[model samples]
Target: MGNFTKWLGAGLGFTLGGPIGAIIGYAIGSVIDSGVSVQEYKSEQDDYKRKTKKRPKVKSSTSGDFEISLLVLASIVIKSDGNIDQRELDFVRSHFIELYGKERANRAFKLFNGVIKNEVSTRQVCIQIREHMSHSSRLQLIHFLFGIAKADEVVTASEEEVIRKIAGYLYINDRDYGSIKAMFYNEADAAYKILEIEKDASIDEIKKAYRRMAKKFHPDRLQDIGEEHLNAAKEKFQSIQNAYEKLKEERNF
Candidate 1:
């Protein structure tokens, strides 16, 4: 078997079933071709199903599950604007390489090429993810999607619409969605939005909002997910800090 097939077989968990599973199964079939036997893939699914049936409830997402879900969503967002830019594709590829070494990133891109061909049902995929992933992880997923959308330096209307739908389906409230979305834009109120506050709020309210946002976007909350995600969380946490600092300077507090 090929390295990508081996990694796919071992890494996936809850993503081995549901809409996400079906999408990934199709991608695997398309990409691996003769590298992986049908029985071997089915056996892995059966093993996962049996293990899940024995458990009390569905567990939080595994890193493998997160990786595949990210790829799937990235494909959806990349196609949303009707025209796929190479820079956006490069961003996804390089981001993966940075997060998971060159070898694993190459394997991921092979699977991603297959995924990009399929038309995904964004709502179903997001629902499946919402049911399994933690809130913090879901937040991180939104942050990453916005990064993908803005990779070309301009987020198209279509791309923003698709991502907004995804956030809603994933059960991310407006405040949280706006906060992550604002991180990619340079509007006058961007800092206030990132902190989830109004511009006319008192200095005390701004301080309170900063503390709340800082806690919500804290890197430690994602420590259990993985080091790669923890690093991403740090970027998000820093954004909150920068927003707070900006507001503080503006208010002279």
Candidate 2:
């Protein structure tokens, strides 16, 4: 996360394509000077040319670009409540440090601050992320944004609106949105929605949802995302468990 000038281009494996790459170009390049050596990055200008001459590229399963997108998009949620709160900044910093370690986190913080100061289009960002990210990864990203919005311990009306907009633009399914939202908010029908079952669904149906969601969010199932996100997935796993427990208690199961 040092001066991205050295590692911002294809030479450094930042090949998250479409709107995401477009965003990186403007977000990191506008304020930072190019430090990429001519010898290494010289072919970057003809990126499209090379692609046409070569085989169709396969998207990387590596989480590198996903991690970068998290930092950049988290900043958007931070600024959603009208003003940035100190507690929110601390929360984001702690998550950053935990994931990237202190040195890289510091550099990421500097870059994130610069990013939020600009007028970023959330819809455009979502389009990019949706195109490049896997379904499970998108779920994780929304969960991360909710963590940021609740940093001050409460998500304001404005913040919920923004987060919902983000999920919508990401082409995220409505059921997925309901499931994730139920994890944090205490709405009366949250448990039912979290399971993605009808209020009048049979107990067997509820049980099916519980297992499906649990399997979907299990930490072991997410190992491919690398270690950094396993804990986040666990948080979601527990929430799904809790919702099922609530359903059982309500039904005297």
Candidate 3:
């Protein structure tokens, strides 16, 4: 729990307030219930306050804010379909391990377990996120939620519906939402959708759309979020590339 405390102390900012803070406070209670001393936790909290007191507050979301938000939103999406699939749980755990290492991932999963058992107010949570997080970061969050929904190789309608609502609440526009959603589906027009273009788009139009989306979803947009999220952004970046390449091939451009 030392690492967990350190992470909470250092990697959080705006998330320590609002609805997110309320959720995290509950999770922290669960942590205390699990045997971590309240004194130790308070000490860490005091340390964090001291460290951050002199620093100017920035609107950008911190890595810990993004991480906790992911866990909370994931819990909502997992339960959206009315059953918790072990495969989705495994996907979330494995993805966290890959992003945060084994120890950190284990600690996060402990919090996730607490988060998953709660009833999340999705709109309220998303409104809070929209206020603090960047548009690119929110898009990445949607991408991750889709990955969870599709973990069983089938994205259920309920899951998709819930994700769409999340996207809307996060202020993701229709074209952007369609573009990201296209990454998880194999429909005939998926490539066009992924590029935010149309099937009937001319070669020049397609090229322009590809360039625009390439810039929009570039991995560097997430660099400040941490290497793990940057790597995930690369995956989304590659999907755009693949979609563009497919279009180029089909159009003989």
User: Per-residue CA lDDT of candidate 3, range 126-224, in tens?
Assistant: 998998898999999999999999999999999999999999999999999999999999999999999998778999999999899999999888776
Show where candidate 3 strays beyond 4 Å: 31-58
Q: List model 1 lDDT by residue over 1-253, tens digit each.
A: 2444457757776787788777876775655446668776565445544543543444677888889999999999999988989999999999899888898888888789879989899999999999888888899999999999888999999999999999999999999999999999999999999999988989999989999999898888876467877777889899999999998888898
- Candidate 3 has its poorest 10 consecutive residues by lDDT at 48-57
Candidate 2 clashing pairs, residues 3+ apart or interchain: none
TM-score of each: 0.90, 0.80, 0.90
In Å, residue 150's CA in model 1 sits off its true spot by 0.8
Give the range where candidate 1 is weakest over 10 consecutive residues by summed lDDT.
48-57
lDDT of 1 at 65: 83
Which structure is stronger by lDDT: 1 or 3? 3
**lDDT (CA) for every model shown?**
0.84, 0.72, 0.86
Model 2's alpha-carbon lDDT is 0.72
Which rank order by TM-score, best down to worst? 3, 1, 2
